[model samples]
Target: MEREIVVIATSNTHKLDEIKEILSDFQFDIKSMSEVGLGGLEIIEDGSTFEENAMIKAKTVMNKTGYASIADDSGLEVDAINKAPGIYSARFAGENATDAQNNEKLLNLIANVPEDLRTGRFICAIAMVFPNGESIITRGTCEGSIGFEPTGNGGFGYDPLFIVPEYNKTFGEIPAEIKNKISHRANALNELKSSLKVYLERI
Candidate 1:
């Protein structure tokens, strides 16, 4: 029988669905935190960096459930803002602020800045935790710029304003299939797949 693997750290359904889609090629049964009766593990993200936060969640879940687990922490880093929202992208406006509020605040802050100064990148840090308390980390980033206004309605959060240079479309405007193929999460997942291919084969 194959070993059980779970991604039971985030409450965000969007994140969960995205990860599940990415891991579809794998052989093991993949389950979210709710399916594994781990929906109540409140792993507070108090780490100072993305990698630290990802590890915190991954280790907590791995120790709690004794299963191979994965977690990710991602954010938008604005170069001209000196990475103002690098670790606080989710709560940029406030603790409970909605995506619209966060986007409004970001747009207002950079309203006077030039187009070139609006450059930013989405960064994702993925951490994997094993049953033996060992862990591995990988990172991915997608470069882009923040549009003057939100342009599309497909994705949530800052997607509407994130213009991908290569596609000439905001993340929200691109198909989910296309976005998943080139998003920061996809990049990190590819790295994770490469790093864990051998371990998975042995399991």
Candidate 2:
């Protein structure tokens, strides 16, 4: 049997890796947008919500490639700051902000806030768009708080400062093997996988 192809509409290497790892057991062959010749494709993410942004990317990719595609919009939301840097997590520092810069900015933003009040969460919304205009969306969130200083160094983006309450460790401190099972992306992908199973069976 030939393996089905599913293009993940993302250029962020970290996100691509996480999605691939979470869906490793699936029968479909997953390819990053760059791998599938959509590297230069730019889709504007002006959606007010994660789901809308995810849909924009997925639909754009599916229309351009004529293949089923999955896209996710994820970010860190801090309750202390009224959920700032939500959709703009990537450009939190600036348009060309580096991961380190973004992390530092986050740390400084909540530096004065008390540890007990530093509540936050990571949210991920995944959208799958098929060629026939059918689509499915799933969302997941990892509730936690922000650390005053960045810790460890494994995951990307704001991982170093985003604390996982259950483990009492920042995502950067958590190993990939363990992070893959509990991260926001993992949760969203798990939901996506369930829908993919039904979609695969139908087709």
Candidate 3:
């Protein structure tokens, strides 16, 4: 039997690859918006929260393709900065800002903050919208502190600055194998997998 075509509502290749690797074991042919002929579709993320943004993206894509679509809205929330850069993480520095620029902005904003007070978390909210109007939303968070400077050049965005106290390393320094297990996106995807099992079995 042919696998089900599940669309991932994202244009970022990095995020698409990460999610694809995580969901590879499932019996579905996961695809991106461009691959499914809807590359031009854009949904405004006017939502104030992660869940709302994720749902908006997922539902929009699902409606466009009439297929099950998944979307994620994730960001870093720094306690010292009052959890700012939450939903605006992507554009924290400015519109169309580079990852390095955003990281620089974040570091500058909390430059005076002490090490112990640099606590924060990576938050991910995943939403899935099925063709039948049924949907699922799950959230995951990974706690850590912001490093004074960027570290290894492995992961993207704030990965180089996010220090995992337990590992004594940032996500950028850790191996992909390890990150796939503990990342906020990984955690949320794991939960989605569990619920997806029931849906997959039904089909």
lDDT of 2: 0.90
**For every candidate structure, what is the RMSD over all alpha carbons to the true structure, in angstroms?**
1.6, 1.5, 1.5
Each candidate's clash count:
0, 0, 0
lDDT of each: 0.87, 0.90, 0.93
Q: Candidate 1 local accuracy as lDDT?
A: 0.87
**How well does candidate 2 score on lDDT at residue 133?**
90
50-165 per-residue lDDT for model 1 (tens digits)? 99999999988888777878899999998878987888999999999999999999999899989888999999999989897667788988999999999989988899999999
Candidate 1 clash figure, as a count: 0
Of the two candidates 1 and 3, the one with more favorable TM-score, higher being better, is: 3
Model 1 Cα shift for residue 47 (angstroms)? 1.0
Candidate 3, after superposition: displacement of residue 38 in Å? 1.5
Best by TM-score: 3
Which ranges in model 3 have alpha carbons more than 4 Å from their true place?
Answer: 201-203
Candidate 1 local Cα displacement, residue 113, angstroms: 0.8
Clashes of 2: 0
Summing lDDT over every window of 10 consecutive residues in candidate 1, give the lowest-scoring window: 1-10
CA RMSD (A), model 1:
1.6
